[model samples]
Target: MAESSTARVIRLRPVDDVAIAAVDVAAGTGVDAGGGVVVARDDVPRGHKIALRALRAGAPVLRYGQVIGFAGRDIAEGEHVHLHNLEYREFRRDYEFGVDARITEVLAEADRDTFAGYVRSDGRVGTRNYLGVLTTVNCSATAAKQIAARLRHSGVLDEFENVDGVVALTHGTGCGMAPDGEGAAVLRRVMRGYLTHPNFAGFVVLGLGCEDNQIAALTRDVHMRPEVPVFTSTIQELGGTRKTVAAGVARLTEMLPIANAARRSRVPASALVLGTNCGGSDSYSGLTANPALGNAVDRLVRQGGTGIVGETPEIYGTEHMLVRRAVSERVGRKLLERIDWWREYTAKNGGSMDNNPSPGNKAGGLTTILEKSLGAVAKGGTTALTDVVEYAEPVTTPGFVFMDTPGYDPVSVTGIVAGGATVVCFTTGRGSAFGCAPVPSIKIATNTPLYQHMTDDMDINAGGIVDGDTTVEQVGERIYRRVLAVASGEPTRSESLDYGEEEFVPWHLGTVM
Candidate 1:
C-alpha cells in the first residue's frame, strides 16, 4: 500500500499494460489510471493484476517490464488480468553466458566483516553448535527423536551454553526400495550432507540396521574418517528401540562435554554460507522482499561469503537470467543440464514443470510457473553464479551457487542447508512458519498485511517497501545486518518457537518398487 499515492493500483514499469491492485477494488469503482482514472470493469482483489488498457486476444501481457503471459481473450481496460483472461505460453528465452556477470570487489582480508561462530576441526564455521540425532530410516526416527528428547528433558544442555540445542532430523524414506537405485543415491546424499553439516558439534546416526541407507556406507563414501565425531548404531544390533535409545543416550552424554567444548570465535564473513529461499510468494515477492534479499546476497558475496539458492522448478523460466550471470560457460551449462534433468524427472513422474505455482501461489497472484519463477530467483541477487551443485552436495565454491532440488520449500531448504548453508533467509508474500536448525532462518514478510498478521513468525518486514516507508535497498541492508547478527547467536522467531526438528525432509528421487 506504500508504492503509489493512489495506493489502489501500481504500474511497475512504464511499458507495462497491467497494474497490480494494492487493495481490493469494487466493480465500477474509479481507479487511478496513470494520468487519468478508469473504472474497474470487474471486482479486482488485492495483489491481483488489472489491465491498464484494452488488450486484443493473444496480446502479450506485461508486468515488471517483462511479459508474464498472453491475453487469452480480448480484455477491456481496468479488467482483471488473471487466469480468467490471461494464459501461459511456452517461449524460448535466450541464454547468453557471463553477459550480466559482475565480479565482486573482494574485501581486503583485514577489512572483511566478521561473525562469532564455532570454527570446526574441518575448518568450517558453524553458526550454532548443535548435537544432531539423525535417522537413517523411518523406523529409526522415533528412537532418534527419543534420544534427543531424553537429552532435552533431562536439562542436559543447560550447562552447554555454546551448544545451541539438540535436533533430531527424521525423514520418511530410507528403506523399502532398491538399495542401489537413484532413490538410494539421493537418500545417501541427504544423509551425507547432514552428517557432515558444520552446525552439528557431533551427531548420532540411528538406523534399523537393515535399511538401505546404511550409516556405515554413508561415512565411508562421503569422505568421513572413522575418528570423526559421528556415532552410528542400529535398533536391531542394539537389541531394541529402548536399548538403542539408551546406547545413544550414553554415547551422546559422553559427547556432551566434547561438543560443548566448542566455543565461538570471530570469523570473517568469508566463513559465512547463506541460503536464500522464498515461499508462499505473491506478485510482490519479486517487486520487494526477494529483490531485497538479492541485495543482501550481493553484499555477502562481496564479502567473499557463499549464497546458496535452489528449488530447481522455481528457477525454470528465470534460468536464462541466471545463465547470463554464470561465472563461466561451463557453470552456465551445468545449470541448463539440471533444468533438463528436472524436465525428464517430472515427465517420468507423470507431471509437468508447469505443475508448480501451487494453489496458494495462484491465489497470491502468481499465474504460471514462469511468473512464479521470475519472482523466485530474485533472491539470488546480482552476482556471478560461480557454481552449480547437485542436491545435498557439499558446496566448495564460494559466491552464488545453484543447487538442484524440488520446488517444495522444506525439501529445497534441506538441500541448501545440507550443502553447507550456515544461515538462511526466506521471503514470503503470504505467511510461512519455517525454521532451520543449526542454521537460523530469518523470515521477511513481503507486504504489510502479512507482516502485521504474522508478526510472531516474521523477523523482517519488507512491507515498508509496499507502504512507501522504505526502499528495497534500505530493507536489504537491514536484512544483511540481521543475518550477521543471527549468525552471531541471535535467535530467530522460528528458532524461539522450536520449529526445525520436524522439517528434515530429503528429496526422494525414485519410486519404491
Candidate 2:
C-alpha cells in the first residue's frame, strides 16, 4: 500500500483490516484509509494499530496479511485494537513441507563480496582475534575474569595490535546441575563451541577441581585442535584463586605474541555466520527492523554466507512459514519436534507459552506471544531452511538454517554464537543494548525514536523505513554491508560501549541438584 507523503497511518498490506498508527492519534483524529476517511474513536499510541473496519466478537483480526488474533469483543472502525479487544487462540497451521523451498541464485565467487579477516592456521576464517578465558564452573568465573583482567590492567594487549582484546567468557553454572544428564551435556557443548570458535586465537578453560565440571574432565573429553591452543587449570590444584589467576596470566602472556602475530587477509563472505534475534520488540519490529534484517539475510544467503534464525518460542505461531521453506520434510519435522518440546516443557513448569509479551511488549502494541512470534519470524528472510540444529550444536550448513533456542535474548544469542555464529545482528523496537562478545553484535533499531534515544548503542536505524524516509531494501543493504564491516574488524556501537561482558548466559536445562 503506497502511503501518502504525510500520512500518519501505515497500511502494511492492501488486504489488511488494520492500519498501524504511524504517530500517536488522539481521539477524533481523522485519517484516510484508502477507501474512505476514518476518525479515531479513542487515543491510540504510536505503533499501535487502529481497526480499519467493524468486527464482531470472535472475528479474526489481521495484520501483515495474517491473522494476529481474534476480536474479544465488537471492534469499531478507527478504535484502538490491542490487549483490551484482541485475544490469543490456538489453531492448527498447515505446514506444507518444502512447499516454498527453492534453490538460491548464488552469486559467482569472483563477483561475490569479500571482507578482511584473520585466516586461522586450520583454514578457518576469523572475524576477530581475541584470546579467551573460559570457565567450567561458577566457582571458576572470578578466576577466569581475573585472568583476563590481569592482561587488561597490565596493558599487554596494547602491544598485540592484531589481537582484539582478552575476553573472560565466564558463566554461572556447571556445579549443581545433573553431571551426566542433558544439562551437563549442554554445558560441555557450549564450552567446546566457544573453544573451537574461529574468533579465539587461543583460550584457557579453568575450573574448580571439586565441581562436577572439572578442568581435567573437560580436557579429557574435548577433542582439542592443534591449530588452536587450549590450556587448563583448577583452583584447588593451583592452590587458590590468586595462584590460579597468576598461572592463567602467565599462560596467556606466553601466547600474546603468537596471538598478535595473526593477521587479517581477504576472505570470501561465505566464511561468516550471522546470528539474528529480535528483543524488546514492538509492533513496528515486524514492519520495520525485522523485515529489513530478513532482506539482509536473503542477501547473505545468496552470496553463499550462513545466516542463523533461532529463538524457538519467538517463532511459535509463525513456524509453519519456516517449515514450508524447509529443504526437506526431515528438516520440517525437526522444527515441529522442538515446538512440541517447548509446549511440553512449559506445561510441565506450570506455565503457558503466552506468558510472554512482558508488560513492555504490551505497551509497545504487542498483546500475546502468538502475535509477537508472527512478527519475530520476519528476521529469517525468505531463504530455504537448509537445516535445523539443536542448541549449542555446530551449524555446518551454509545457507539459512534454524537453531532451537529459548526466546530470552542472551540465551538465544548464546546458543546461536556457540553454533558458530561469528557475528550477531539483533533487532529491537523498545530498545536493547545486548551484545555477544568474541562475536561482535550489530544493533538495528525498529523505530526512529528508539534509534535516536539509543544512538550510542544502536548501529543502524531501520525505523527510517517506517518513517518512509527509506525503503526496506535500502536499509537491508546497509545492514548486510554493516555485517561485512563488523566482520572486517569494524567495532559496533555495543562493542564500543563494552556491553558484551555480563551477557554471556548459557541455557540452563533441567533442575538444579
lDDT top scorer: 2
**Candidate 1, 56-112: lDDT as tens digits:** 999888876777878999999989888888887878789999999988888987998
Regions more than 4 Å wrong, model 1: 1-7, 33-36, 225-228
- The alpha-carbon lDDT assigned to residue 440 of candidate 1 equals 93
Q: After superposition, how far is residue 319 of candidate 2 from its true place, in Å?
A: 1.2
TM-score, cand. 1: 0.96
Clash tally, candidates in order: 3, 0
Looking at candidate 2, the ten consecutive residues that score lowest on lDDT are 1-10
lDDT of each: 0.86, 0.87
Tell me how far the alpha carbon of residue 249 in candidate 2 is from the true structure, in angstroms, after superposition.
0.8
Candidate 2 per-residue lDDT, tens place, 92-119, comes to: 7898999999779889899789999887
